[model samples]
Target: MNRPQYILLPVSPIFIAISLIAAFLLNLMPWGQFIAAPDFVALVLVFWGVHQPRRVGIGTAFCLGLLMDVHDATLLGENALAYTLLSYCAIMMHRRVLWFRISTQAMHVLPLLLLAQAVQLLVRFIVSGKFPGWFYFVESFVSALLWPLITVLLLAPQRRAVDKDHTRPI
Candidate 1:
């Protein structure tokens, strides 16, 4: 059986802010040291960049990236540049991406995530002359794997009908 297409409600600005803050908070956890630990901020930024381009665009991504750069104590603008680029790419491809299934969308997003990671990696290399190893790219792969779950979760609020359907049982 085919699933019904949802007519999504308008997303709330407050919800967007909360989600972005929550993602940043998640990154603040100590587990971020793990090579496989996904970048929560990047994931959420990409989501909003695609779903609500006008509401969350390059400036939001840049600001969040700066916050991450400060929090990570790396060179200023490292995460900012990466996130800004990711946001731009997401906005460019949003219409094409919205046409695909969740899994396919994740596939499309993997490269963008990797590109962002590559940007960070390149900046690190230029500034410190260090290669973080092949494992450094694993986080983007993991984030891509998580795209479906994140999409479902972040889009939940907008998925609800404006008014409850009380015609039938609860």
Candidate 2:
């Protein structure tokens, strides 16, 4: 039996902004301890960087990082540095990563997330002169674990409704 294919609707820039804003607010919410609280902003930034590289690139990542830095009241460039690197990785692997299913994509995403966290940890260590401990790495793994969910949620608005009449082969 032939299956119907659903086309993607055009994603509006406004939707992207709303998602990033929502992610920022989610990141701001206290999740008991820092280790358990996944960095929603970073995840969303990576998602956009991968899916919409042309629209959301290093500059956007840097600006969002600055905003996050302001929100968290940390060293101004801490997140900017990490996010810039994350965006670079996402953009670099976008085509290759997009070819995989979301579950498989997590394997590809692991290093990028870990690197972003490492940059943040390094920045904190340099300025504060203290190691945050192994628990600090938990958030990166958690962020990777949440990648499939994040991909689904963020892509929901862009999923087009199935049109039966349009099932004819092009």
* Deviation from native of the Cα of residue 57 in model 2, angstroms: 1.2
lDDT of each residue in 18-105, candidate 2, tens digit only: 9989998898888736348888888998999889998888998899899989988999999999999999999999999987888889
lDDT of 1 by residue, 1-170 (tens): 27567888899899999999999999999996755899999999989988999999999999999999999999999999999999999999999999889999999999999999999999999999989899899999999999999999988988776779888332
Among all candidates shown, the one with the greatest lDDT: 1
lDDT of 2: 0.87
Q: If scored against the real structure, what TM-score would every candidate get?
A: 0.95, 0.89
Give the total clashing residue pairs for model 1. 0
Q: Which ranges of candidate 1 are over 4 A from the true structure? A: 166-170
Which pairs clash in the backbone of model 2?
none
